[model samples]
Target chain A: MALKLPFLQVDVFTNTPFKGNPVAVINCMNIDESLLSDKQLQAIANWTNLSETTFLFKPTTDGCDYKLRIFTPMCELPFAGHPTIGSCKAFLQFTGQKTAKSLKQECKSGIVNLTISSEGKISFKAPRADIEEIPQDVINEYRKILQIDCVAAPKLLDVGPIWVVYLTSDAESCYNANPDFAQMAIINNKYGHGGIILAGKKPGSSQDYEMRAFVPADGVQEDPVCGSGSIALIRYLQDLHNFTETTEVNITQGGRLTRQGEIFCQIKGNADGAFSYISGGNATIVIEGSINI
Target chain B: MALKLPFLQVDVFTNTPFKGNPVAVINCMNIDESLLSDKQLQAIANWTNLSETTFLFKPTTDGCDYKLRIFTPMCELPFAGHPTIGSCKAFLQFTGQKTAKSLKQECKSGIVNLTISSEGKISFKAPRADIEEIPQDVINEYRKILQIDCVAAPKLLDVGPIWVVYLTSDAESCYNANPDFAQMAIINNKYGHGGIILAGKKPGSSQDYEMRAFVPADGVQEDPVCGSGSIALIRYLQDLHNFTETTEVNITQGGRLTRQGEIFCQIKGNADGAFSYISGGNATIVIEGSINI
Candidate 1:
């Protein structure tokens, strides 16, 4: 069983070379259960040492679009934003599996819409997800670890499979504070919920608003531009603002790691107040090369 | 010119088996200049996939106790808390180099005390460091990524050569945030100081307080019990609360990681408000195996 074909190493979060997080985007595989062991995938991802690496595979049971399984240096995850978006973008750029402007990315969470704009920004319309209302004591537990005073009750905001909203009084507080990174990694693995979706408003300008989504549970400490988190944060903000149309906002991520990049996102909600359309600026393909190894 | 002995893997941060973060500790080399390259060291550390790794060797020159180098999966690091504490602990446990009750750990920053107790707890007393004051604009920038509000002013807190102090307002606004781990690893390699230390008064507790640290810069999203952070945090609280003599305190970390551990620390200050001594609890060693590769 010799397996040697081709692989591409692409930068997922940034367009720059060797700057943003590098992701090894492989070609799509069949739904065969024996494609690659999770351990092997993790080793490869670890070897690459990218924030995330995706293994695009054909769906075992095809209902809509294609399937992708994402892995990090450590473990496998149920759902992820950058891996999803990056995989879709890489698939289109490398394998040319994107037959349409919009693609239905199938995962354990179900089908998600991946829209590739002419500007190259990929937009994802996440499915209707459930949110949770965590207990004050539990929230207190988080507060103790983060070393901040209580702001407001954190509402659970789920886009696809699930999510818990960890609310800050505003985005400024989130940006300003320093956390115990080691402790966060431990807790993230303990309480599993995709991760905590953080919400906050920027004072000053309309473009000054800030949002940071945490998902240590999913093996990611933080994401540059979390696509699913965008779904959750936008939903939470829209519900607060009481809006139906899209809210053009700037998503700035990758403060602690890598360089900072902004994604221009538009939040479109439905009449029922559920999340509807999440359109964003186009994405630029940074790396596209085959690896002999 | 094949090498005889290869570098080995070592665990750090956890006492129990298969828990806490694992860091690969590699012995430093003195190969023919042609045999070793900086790229090779980074590649070896990257291959380990641990958040952080260490390379130790006697310095080519004299005057220093011993020359120690650290590397993340991505790049080299000037100084880090866990590796410093863990590496020194490992050095004493296995190599038994520093036979004294306490030894000074020489690094880029200077010398810090690495003390081993009969109880087996390794207390590394970092040098008296300083905390820098942070401005509102800096807080604003962090808010974009952290989604936090209410920050305290910044101050510089140092241990040995490394020094930093975080200023954050409320804790509840942001808690248990998980960043994109890969992005953090890359960021930490390029820029020094991997994590941010944030803290607040523990709500509903008498003497206890709350805090978490973020380190996207160090390839680690959060650390459970940071020795330096513990030192800085205790020192900061002493300054904030004006505590004198020996201050016995319990700090909680990694509620996000689910590997919740308490750091029992004692902050010893001067009669006239000068910093004195820092002592803390013990850690158990869980893993002692080899990597087959």
Candidate 2:
């Protein structure tokens, strides 16, 4: 059946149009990859032409959950937060299906659980972090290149990957952050598995940590809300502050590009082992549509 | 003044249109970015909407040395190869500038020294390689999730910040390889950085490495003529094969989407450090016009 995809294009980090990271969400029906090929998916993805486009896969199971697929102009990703939240909201309005009240996204990463509140805000919980350490010189170069004054020094803290944790002072500091990308590539090429983390104190609280991330060398210059980076920051705060009680904090990102949003993280558990569960309030569906590839 | 840029939606990796990766290169007079705002450049990039577009910074100053900028549909990339080669070839004709036997490109990744033979085959030395080790579980899941057979254990190597390398056997096996990305995301979310590297013995090589990279996790799923990935592969083969002199190999990629072509690389140096340079045998131009944006 030809479906009318209720597509919306909203900036992922910002609430306004054209300001935030552009994300497109589509309410899809009767179309599955089984009926499609990667080329076709890629064609559609290229046409939609956003950072990412999402689809709510209605698998015909009432009591069970639905599937979602996210694609960039280049390829189809296993898991992505904005796409998930955006698609879930679109799915709710698409088939008028009983929204799971929450969704457990079975992505390439694992079971990513997202809860959509009645107020239209969506929150997602990511897997825990396992921090690691990186070289010092690589750290220094990123700081020098990113040009964001180090509110916090560089450390190897494991989020999903051992992030080269770069802590900055505040959202404003992260906003004004400038990077010599050419020079930063030198450091990025030097280190294989660590990204720079820039963060500061939380906006409303002195409880834990707030931060942003930059890995343009890895294709993303700035992430509107980096789930992976947050995982690392939460763990870093736990180690530095010597506190662990779901140390909740909001990390702002995408300020320079203007798609600013906050990530909510809780570093819970004991000293021996702690988990960093990061979330960005809830994502609103920006737009929906389907392409005839 | 706005220009009526001549653009060609040429398939890159393959000779036949739509059989390989498609790159739409525009023929326009070279200009300066200093005069254009980043937003305007981004808008120009958005208008091009190619995987990567090149703006010949200006006519060659020092004989063959050319300056250029690369932009994806979304924004400007620090460096890119397809655009690098495509734009240079187009520029040579756009300005009716004579090729002085050889070519050299000053790109975001530094200088690419090109040797354009009378055969019309252009070859250049790429940047150095920064090889990384691929994790065990990441490789295991890539096979299971993407549903492609892993010819051998995968390796994660980065030439620059943009390219992360993975290896597989045979283009046929992996070219059509598509993973249940949702599952790959589970692992990527857990691991952070890792992408697909599918390849086989070059069309006819004993010691060389070949591959098709998939990075759905980082916005682009499969990049056409990933200059960075190819550079790292050259180094990987040189170190793995214990070749003392320049290791020569051919990398074929972007065929699935009709952006097909081969990048020829040479590895020069010893075990301490080496240089990975790539050149391609391609057609220069059959384009006319400009971008109004």
Candidate 3:
């Protein structure tokens, strides 16, 4: 007899189908972990061929509702934003845990908390982050690749996953620019970061800013919508531009890639001290079924 | 209630589940053609995010058993080899048509006849092709990109799909070569061909020849097992190297990428006149389920 593994294909960062990044979520709580080897997990991820596929298991650690294992087509990730949101939605819906006010997820990064509302809105407390300076020559190389004149001093920020943040005054420039991906991949590999996130304030919309992430090193030229990138960008803004402790901003990303994803962000506390960034978005379950594999 | 569509995930060109290229096949014969718009088809293909997804429908053309439509994550392809094999296997198994000796498929590329054996071996006759001389400057560019010393006078072969064929004496060199993809993409775009195919005779294995295809412009760096490429290569050898009409050889590809797919090829008739090249391989059905798309 074939084993029926419950699966969900969720589109994250947007409520609409085919408009956001899609992640395959599998519930492996009932199965023995030893049965599914690392090679099998990698093969499942490769079958999906998506940016990431997540497997959910019962938490083995305290203070966590569930454990999440994220895998890209090529390798596994400590944690990823969209997969987090997608997996959370699938878990809540599948286990009938949506009534809970909040949930804790234990991943390779560590324990992360998410707050849920009555209306199904989910927001995550950004993981602890660190900031570092990037090399000037590398910054020049990025400027050339992104086809931008200048940027507000690129910074290497680590929020679970590392990202090189490039702040620009004009978001349209980043949205419209077609960077040399081949060259960008070289730079990304050299910097040893996830990718470069270019951010700027939105022109007229209620959304505070727009951002785009280019991750050529990962073979993804441009990320459609990046939850982790958004959180780190806000942290960078708080430190460089001195954002208020109670600041709330809406971010629009994936415009260049036609995904046009929206992420709601809220920051609490000052940059001089510890701060928590909350990133929230809607996800649509595009596919639901039992996968024999 | 959600409508469940019969679906199959098949690994093409190899019998192993995870080794060869995987394509998702959906049987849409029961569904109304008007109900499934082009946008919906593209959306479904995008959701799968595979190299190719195929939809099977009843043939509108006479003498054709079925009609197949192929789509990549980015766009639809008029013709593709792996998808053809994958779709055929799925259709035959799902429709209980396996007892048939042969099958005819109608697609955007025209009618394709496939011969199936009692042992489940499937072979396709190579399409008509025309060979032309390649430019000297382009040959030099290919030599630089392939990191090769020299190649037999390059030939531009139009076998349904146009391919720039490079005949090198060193099969190992072609198998191990890692050309600069960024530059190769530029060269492919400049040449306006499907991709460059490098072919040479393997040393020890009965699989007399080894080949590799680089299709950077199509965003696929290397094709795991290219049926059409193998056909064109045999044609080139028959004319250039004076191979006999009954010459049959087995070929391996995608070694650098670790796919290592095998393809058997046989050429009939002379290059001065009409010829038929038969390409055959094994396919394994990896996943079967009803997908609600």
Candidate 4:
């Protein structure tokens, strides 16, 4: 028997098409669960070959609107930023529910809240992180890889994925820095995560900071516009730079790799209490069709 | 204007639906050149996220049947193995030309000859390689990376894409060898290519050897079933061991990363003169649709 799964290729974080990060959203609401296996889901993800391809299914939780399983070509992710936003956009469009204000998405990471505006802009509250100190060995490795001595101490921040955050004084250096990926992967593997975010103040621009995310551990060298990375950066800023509850920041990423993307985020609450990060972005649907599997 | 491009996702080098390598083929024969640019082509490739996506166009060469442009999520390739075979299968099926015995494909690497049989097995002559000696520094790096003191001296073989070939005495070691991708990428960049292949003798099976191809430089950590890689292996075997002309060898690859795939090949002509390596495999069409982009 053949199954027709609705597929959407959505570009998230930018209003322009082909300018931001792209994700493949497969809606399997009507398809039988028996037809799709973990291997099959992984196969579909591998077929799309995207950084993340999310499969949407009916949520088992009482308050959750839908459940999303995100997969890279290699493995499954508990939660991902662009896939969450992209899947929300796709679910709204596919279900013809245009006026919904908020959505609770169920994933391996748990149900997360997503707010949608009438203008089609989507935002999700970033999960709180378990902050930790960067190991000295990791610091020494990055120092040699980045060729910089005058930099903030590296902090390992875990929101969903662990991101080793490095703050550079020079945005230009942040843009130009080429960390040896082999060494970077070693550090990432040592921590059992797949990413590192380098952020620096990008003064005098529309965006507040310039960032680049490298996830060689996950087979993605550089993420164009990372939503989760943005959240981690916001959390890092709150701890180090003292961002306020109402502080809204615009960050630009993926410039060096030429995908030039912008991410808008707001940090809420204080450092002592429950801090929530709201990441907002625009998504453009590039392909709408049914995938036969 | 809405453009309709014929799309086919074919699994090459295997007869199964989800195994082997999957390539998305976009037939742009009827679409005007103005409707698509290099950027659009890249966007489509990125959308598919497959190891490679191919665009089929009218051949610029006089005797060639068609021209193919191959793209990964990151960049375009002059020519690729699975795409060549998969595109041939898609084009033959789409154009209702199953009776044809042979086809000439034109790509940036120039025209290549492909043969098809009534049994539906597809084979193409592998391009000759420009062989070079392995640098001592690179060999040392791999020695440390693989954690093995004994490995055959690496040979840089440039077919369509350059592949660094390393032979191991133990097939288990070949399967278990995990080199640092970042270091591999550095070596690839230093050599201006994006692949490293590990090959070793298989004790007893239809396959003579076990191989794995890693192209992290192209964002592919491990290629499931690599056709170009098979050709390079054939060349390596002929040189390292005296596999004679008319030697038919079956090889299995991608066992470690779990997508166990097989490739069949034959070495033609004498070792001294022009030698052609023919790579043969099966393909299954998984998706057929008209894409509007």
* Candidate 4 lDDT, B199-255, residue by residue in tens: 877777534878889887666667888998888888876776665447887888766
Grade the docking of candidate 1: incorrect
Question: What TM-score does the A-chain of candidate 1 achieve?
Answer: 0.79
Give the docking tier of candidate 4: acceptable
Correct interface contacts retained, every candidate: 0.02, 0.00, 0.35, 0.33
lDDT of 4: 0.80
Give the TM-score comparing model 1 with the true structure, all chains together. Answer: 0.49
Chain B of candidate 1 vs. true chain B, TM: 0.72
| lDDT tens readout by residue for model 1, A48-139 | 44667778777655565667777766667677666776777777766565556887787776677778766567777656645567777667
The candidate, 1 or 4, that scores higher on DockQ is 4
lDDT of 2 at A83: 63
Model 4, A1-293: lDDT tens per residue? 66767777788887766678889888888866667899989987876667898999988899999989999877899998988999999999889997899999999998899999878889999755667887788688777866655367778888888898888876788898878876677767876866888888876763388888989766567888899999888888878766444678788887776566878888777558667888888887766666767
Superposition error at A40 for model 3 (Å): 3.5
Clash number for model 2? 60
Give a tens-digit lDDT track for model 1, residues B184-238: 4443344354356666556666446456766655434566556567777777767
TM-score of each: 0.49, 0.49, 0.89, 0.85
> DockQ of each candidate's interface versus the true one?
0.03, 0.03, 0.39, 0.35
TM-score for the first chain in candidate 4 comes to 0.93
lDDT by residue (tens digit), candidate 3, A101-153: 89999999889898876777678887776788888887888888877765578
